[model samples]
Target: MTSIVSVRDLKKSYAGGFEALSGVNLEIEKGEILALLGPNGAGKTTLISTICGISIPTSGTVRVGGHDVVTDFRAARNLIGLVPQEINLEPFETVMNTVRFSRGLFGKPRNDALIDQILKDLSLHDKRDSKIMMLSGGMKRRVLIAKALSHEPSILFLDEPTAGVDVELRKDMWDVVAKLKASGVTIILTTHYIEEAEAIADRVGIISKGSILLVEKKEDLMQRMGKKRLRIELSTPISELPQELADRGLEIAADGNALIHDYDTRSDRTGITALLKDLQNAGLKMTDLETQQSSLEDIFVDLVRETS
Candidate 1:
């Protein structure tokens, strides 16, 4: 995969001497969905701003489609479309005019046909002539996306695009994202929703303390850090574990009806045999068994805690 966007030793600092980004290095492949995961003030937004030429970097370099962001701002910025976190739009303007104006900003010729398609893709075709003030919050969000796509940039940056959005709206947003990627648009998004990142991203990047902590394929990251949980359900509920079972790595469920044992999938010996024999010896009958893997949220929390 060719690199569509490149960052090397990127750093950003304010006059107060607070650093927002520190020696960050990253590469975004062409036509891939990269989800950036981080807590508040973690430099996710700052990185996106710098890459899109909205902010100047204190040091280091960023290249979009082989154009330096600092030296050639217009070329680099022209290849990028940014959907900011805030919903800022002209309330008095119709959706069609709003989207059309954005296209003109990029010196694009008036193409109502392209603008209409963009609106339809965002499910806003019927509301094209409706004033922005007449639309709902969710519809306002779709208009933002339509405006971003109006210029037809090769890359799109979505900063908390689904924040405060309803469940149905979130689902619809991701479906639109899938279609965008299929059309060869490289997307970089900052989202606090771990499940959304896990679902839509081809790759996941974790950022903390103004640095890139980790970036890897979603499946690979989950498999590497994920733990398998063995659930041993008992025929009868027990208030407490036997003294003999206290030393083992087992926790009682909230209902006291099942014992939970977590083990590494890569481990050669899971200790299941010994635990089962001990349970039987203690007169605890195992009526059923179940298993599950850790979710991305579990791994994210653990990673941040370790780094902090």
Candidate 2:
């Protein structure tokens, strides 16, 4: 798990003395997808821009493949590819030309074979010769990805890659990310869609107010911070929780059709047995039972609340 990109004490400031990033330290491992989740104005884009050498860091260091981004700009930049949130492609330019042009920008020799392969990998081969304006939004996004990979960068940064994409298309983008990772491209993507992070990221990093809240394995984060609920369906509707049930930390659902008992998955004793026994003694009839686990969104919201 070698770090391909490392940020140490990174900070960015404006003339008005507004800090976008504050002493941020992060390590993006080689060949893994790291999803950066944050609200608007959380400095996610600024961090990506600085790492790609599009913006200068006010202080501290960012190393891409051990090359300083500020001092060794070309070398560091050549090893990185960035697909920004906007679809700013030249509408008149053909997709093939657009992607090929990106490769040439890196001083790479003409390698149409490689470019074609990248296009094919992104499922954009059929539209390669079409003008940017002719492609759909999802196809345009795929073209952006192709352009990023055209340079054969070791690290790829996707800033809100699926911003306005449909659900199916977003899933397609996830598949593309998987292929990129399998090919040893280290990906660090910023996403507003929390489920996108949950689906594809090996690790999830939460950033807020210019500082990183936490970075952990997606599963570990969910397990450690996530909660579970026992959804006990009642045979009859109730407007409120009975005194006995309220003491057991059970609450009636909004529709009053069931009761919800929230518990930690990591707990050894969930008190379910006692609760069920208590329910029987209280003359409550259970019609069905179901359980639900907290999603990544739940953990993200809770963390933001605590930090804010």
Candidate 3:
């Protein structure tokens, strides 16, 4: 599997001496979906802008499909498409003209059939004759996607594609992304929706304070950094935990109906058997017991906090 995009020691600094990115390195494989996760001001957007040649880097190198982003910008940019966070389409332009014009910008020959396929694939065929100003917010967002795909680039960058949209629209967008993946298009997306990444991304990258914290396979990251919580419903209400059980790091619920214990899944011993035995010895009766694995959002928060 060869990388379609690569970055090395990428850095960006403003005139005010603020660094947006510092020595960032990443590789996006051909035809793979990679999700970039970070808090606001964490430099996720800055990194993507540099890779797509929208913003110049202060230092470092970025290559798209073997073409250097700086030295070979035209060739590199022609192979990639970007859907920015903001919707800035021409208000008076019809949907079909907008998409067709985008293709012409890339020097692609006029092909109504290809443009029609893109419009249909994005569910914007019915709105082809509608003006951009006449469409709703979700419809406008779909137009942006159709325009981006007009050039038929190998790589696509989606920046918060589903922000502020309704649940139904978001799900529809995900379905479109699935079809794009099936067509062998590599996608790199920046999102605040952790669940979306967990549901769609093949790999996850965490960035914080202008640096990439870690990148790993979704399953591997979850298995290695994810924790398991054992929740026990208490039969008897207790104001506080007993001294004998205080060493186990158990947390009593505010409602006084449950006890929560967290244990690392990768640990050699989860101590569940010992903990259960001790609870019985202490005369604590459990009505029910259940375990929950930590979500990607939990792991992301922990990692960012640790680095910050």
Candidate 4:
């Protein structure tokens, strides 16, 4: 896929010498879902704002659809749509009217058909005629998505789209996002929901302290960085560590019912068999055993901590 959005050495520094973004570089494909995972002050929003031309970058370049965001602001901005983290809709405007106005702001001709489809896609058709202030928080978020799609932008930026919504509502929004991806809209979302990214994103980018730590395909990242743990349920509780299994470096569960061993999934010699043999020699009996893989949240937290 071709790159629809490109940032090279992007840097943004606010007054008082606070650096919000630090020489960031990224390429967003034309139709892929890229999720930016980061901590609160990790420059996720700053990168998005600079790319959308909302905040002027101290240095570097951002281009959308081959148009320079700084030099060809209108052309670049026209190709993008942003659903910000904040709910900043006009309280009294009808949903349909607000979406229509957003389309008009982009110099797009009136197209009620497109507007209707967007409302329906977001499950906001029933609320189309209702005032924005009369809707629920989740509905307001749907309206924000509707407005972002009003102009039929090739690229969409969702900044914390599911922040305040319930789990069910968040899942509904994920469905909406999946539909958008299927319709060939490139999506770049900044989210605290690591599970959301793990569920939907084609690629994951971790940012910390105003710089990108890593960017890789979701599955590949998990496979490459993921660790595994082997949990052993002992048949009998041991009061102290056995000398025979002392080299295993196992962790005893708080309840004294289980033992935990961490190992790399990619390693050829995980030492599970040897550990089991050692346990048997030490007169220990294992009642049950289970292995678990580390989740995306684990990988994300590890990256952020390493960089911090």
Give the TM-score comparing model 3 with the true structure, all chains together: 0.84
lDDT of 1 by residue, 220-256 (tens): 9777556899999999999989988998889999999
- Give the clashing residue pairs of candidate 2, or none: none
Q: Give the top-scoring candidate (lDDT).
A: 1
Candidate 4: regions farther than 4 A off = 224-226, 231-292
How many residue pairs collide in each prediction? 0, 0, 0, 0
**Per-residue lDDT of model 4, residues 219-266, tens digit only:** 898785568889999998876778887779798988788898999877
What lDDT score goes with residue 234 in model 2? 92
**All-Cα superposition RMSD per candidate:** 5.4, 4.9, 4.9, 4.7
TM-scores, all models, native as reference? 0.83, 0.83, 0.84, 0.84
What lDDT is reached at residue 179 by model 4? 89
lDDT of each model, Cα atoms only? 0.93, 0.90, 0.92, 0.91
